[model samples]
Target: MNKNCAIVTGSKESAPYTLIVQTTWIYPGWFAGLMKQHAKVTTLLKFIETANPAHVLLEINSEKAPGDFDFVGIPNSNDRIAEGYAKTAKSLAKLITKKIK
Candidate 1:
């Protein structure tokens, strides 16, 4: 079995149901532009094309409200970063629950 499958199954066996969640760069503006400046677009496209129905490529973006916990920025304090991580954990939990069901 593959490393991913072994990690999921805790044995030398494939997972019965695999949900591959790949978190890529933040999208839709400046960060994406920066990424394009560094990486080849063709290579990025080819990498994206590797995903199938079972794969989820999550392109996170900044929150609309700057004060929100999920806002993408260098937080003023560790508490802010912790809050953002908590929000992300909750979101991922919901996503995984939905996918598994």
Candidate 2:
């Protein structure tokens, strides 16, 4: 596990349960082309590395250990994109409620 995951897991000693929410990249819609162009520019400038959606999915899946703590992946939520933040929050709340119950 990574440093962040280690810290979260360690918290299990203090809290009865821990919920880890891993958010994926932004939602790709009509702005796909624009986003791609921006990614290219950022990559060339070394500001950010290109992201692999598949890798992210795999990581989220692998980190899941219901016995240790609850984990959920909220896609299209990497950044607080105004268009989808509400939806993401609702989904997250539902997951958390389900876990707690």
Candidate 3:
């Protein structure tokens, strides 16, 4: 697995370690590239264990970029695909510290 890692800090509060992982997954055209190819419950958990991230900000592109869709508290499985991603994001937050940074 090829992993890309970076430590980013903004202001005093938004400094944390960020990891950019490239895997094999596709969604919409706009945000398809941003999806974590290796993003799985186990994978994310392992990352948290290894990185010990203070605040994990999963971005489709870069830490400064925003997501393609507006996330609202993890979408219903049947509601939308993006919702599921958001849900995964939320769930991952519990195991790891995550926020906009």
Candidate 4:
């Protein structure tokens, strides 16, 4: 696994197993080569490609973000962080759990 970022996949809610990938985003070209290697490398049971879908992050050919985290910060453009939509929405939907006999 490439050492740049962390990838945690699989759902504890429904999925049967855990498949965490500790690597940065994968490029498509690199992935294409990987698929080639898969043809030669196989196991008694099955091959990796047939088993799992490749998780790839397509690289964009564009200018990089000036600052960290926020994208709209050119010369640190005094921008505010976006509120967590799911957290905020769930917070709104929180009802009292008090159960009367």
Candidate 2 Cα deviation (angstroms), residue 64: 18
Positional deviation of residue 18's Cα in model 3 after best superposition, in angstroms = 1.3
Best by lDDT: 3
lDDT of 2 by residue, 1-101 (tens): 22212122333334533334443444332223224211100001011112422222211121111111112221232222432433433444454456666
Number of the predicted model whose TM-score against the real structure is largest: 1
Superior candidate under lDDT, 1 versus 3? 3
Output candidate 1 Cα RMSD.
11.7
Per-residue lDDT of candidate 1, residues 1-101 (tens digit):
12212122232234343333233332222223223111111101111223253353453332321112333433234444344434444444554456676
Question: Clash number for model 3?
Answer: 1
How many steric clashes between backbone atoms does each model show? 0, 0, 1, 0
Candidate numbers, best lDDT first, in rank order: 3, 1, 2, 4
- Please provide, for model 4 over 1-101, each residue's C-alpha lDDT reduced to its tens digit, 9 standing for 90 to 100: 11212333334545433233222222111113223110111111111232343533222221111112323221212221111222222222231112211
TM-score of 3: 0.27
TM-score of 4: 0.15
Per TM-score, what order, best first? 1, 3, 2, 4
lDDT of 4 at 95: 17
Q: Give lDDT: candidate 2, residue 33.
A: 22
TM-score of each: 0.29, 0.26, 0.27, 0.15
